[model samples]
Target: MRIAIDAMGGDFGPRVVIPACIDALTRHPHLSLTLVGQQDEISAYIPSAERQQFADRLTVLHADKVIGNTDKPSHALRQRKQTSMHEALCLVADGHAQACVSAGNTGALMALSRFVLKMLPGIDRPAIITAIPSRKGDSYMLDLGANVDCSAEHLLQFAIMGSVMTQAVAGIAEPKVGLLNVGEEEIKGNEQVKLASRLIKEHGGINYAGFIEGDDICAGKVDVVVCDGFVGNIALKSSEGVARLIGRQLRDGFSGSVFRRLLGWLVKPVLQDIASYIDPARRNGASLLGLQGIVVKSHGGADRQCFGYAIDQAVAEVSMDVPNCINRQLEKSIAIKYRLKRSP
Candidate 1:
């Protein structure tokens, strides 16, 4: 499978993108990569021997322009037609690549993707879905930032999409869907939450697990959490911020005193493993759901390792045929729901 990458979109640009592409090619022999960026800059990162190793498997497309972080989403999409990110997405749209991954301005990515690829049938809006580590394992959260304000119908659609995505990516069967609310009670949240709960409960297509409070997210009470992008974004960022704070405290405590220092040396390996598991850079990337093809959005500040992980994620999505599987599931569920609703 061929994966298209926006090499000039992230903070590290070709320096990290080139190495990560090489690493992915080494590990997955069948994987081909199309780097979208300035050809000269990309060539500088890949040595002659390494280039010869991959040979025709690797190709670089020149994109003289770039989308900056400060540019307005609409303006950038309109002005920077030759941007690396836009060019990479064009590869996917034109069937040149199975998937596209970028660590650029998220707004531009979202806007361009929606405009070029369009939304899936029956989906009102595409959601930004990501896996969040929980006590019971990883849980999927949708509308992470795609839509700041969403209607009850929009949220219900997110629940359906999130449920299918969790099953496809997390290997969960009959994934339980939860509506994020201030309380676990059905009537506790705002008008939107209450209306969404009613629809979810009566929809019969999804495995609705009632309302879930914010605290229940980390507790792993449900496999899929659905909320408006406004709320979901806050929850995701809050969890990430807390994790970083804890990691800093651990580092300081370990080096603060001799006794702690000895303990640190003994448990350093274990701590490192835990930190890696919760690192925002490691889990910061997300997929734009409801599109025709796979599109991964990595953190703008992602390093080489983070970019590598994003490539792995893109490969998984493409290999698993996540979009096809999700579309099939959605069709079956909607069909069943329509028949049931007409019954009695």
Candidate 2:
């Protein structure tokens, strides 16, 4: 399958994206890539031998413009069609590419995706969903800065979409779904969270796991966590901060004394394993769920390896036909609810 890359979008531009693409190509021989950006700049990072090696699998789509980090989503939508990000997404919309991955402006990515791909039939809004590292395993969380303000119905939609994503991408069967609330009790939380819980419990085709508090997120109480974009975004950022803090404290403690340093030396391999497990680079991709097409977003500041992780997600989702799975599951859910409503 062909995957489009916004080569000009990230903090380091093609310097990071090109190497990531090469790494992905090395790992996935079946993958074809279309690097979108100024041809000269992108080609500078790719040596002739490397180009020759992947000639059949790599292509470059020249885009004269780029959407900047500070550009408003609305302005980007109205005036940035010739940009690398926009053209990359267009390739997916036109079916020339199976998926598109970008480390560009998050708001701009979400806006362009909605405009280019449209929403799924039963989905009213698109959500940003990503896998968060958990004790038992990784749990998928949705609405991560996509739609800040959401309704009860929107949260329900996010639950179903997130559930399908976890099942399709994570390969979980009947993935347990939960609402991100302040408390585990059904009576807790505001009107929206409570109503969303009620809807999910009453609906079919979903494994509703009831309310999960913020502390339960990483504990792996559920496979999928649903919340408004405002809450999800904050939770994601806070977790990132805590991860960094823990990493720093561990480093400081390990290097503080000769004895501790000796101990660290003996456990270097184990520490590396633990660090890799918690590193944000290892889990860089966030899915733009509820879109008709597949789009993956990488952190704007992601490095080459981190960006590769994003590409890996896009590749897996494309191979799994995540969008089709979500659409089918949603159709079944709507039918089930309709039948329930019609029943005596």
Q: Judged by TM-score, which candidate is best?
A: 2
Cα RMSD, model 1: 1.4
What are the per-model numbers of colliding residue pairs? 0, 0
Candidate 2 regions exceeding 4 Å error are none
lDDT by residue (tens digit), candidate 2, 226-288: 999999999999998888888888888899789999998998899888887877678999999
RMSD per candidate (Å) reads 1.4, 0.9
Candidate 1 worst ten-residue window by lDDT: 276-285
lDDT of each: 0.89, 0.92
Estimated TM-score for each candidate: 0.96, 0.98
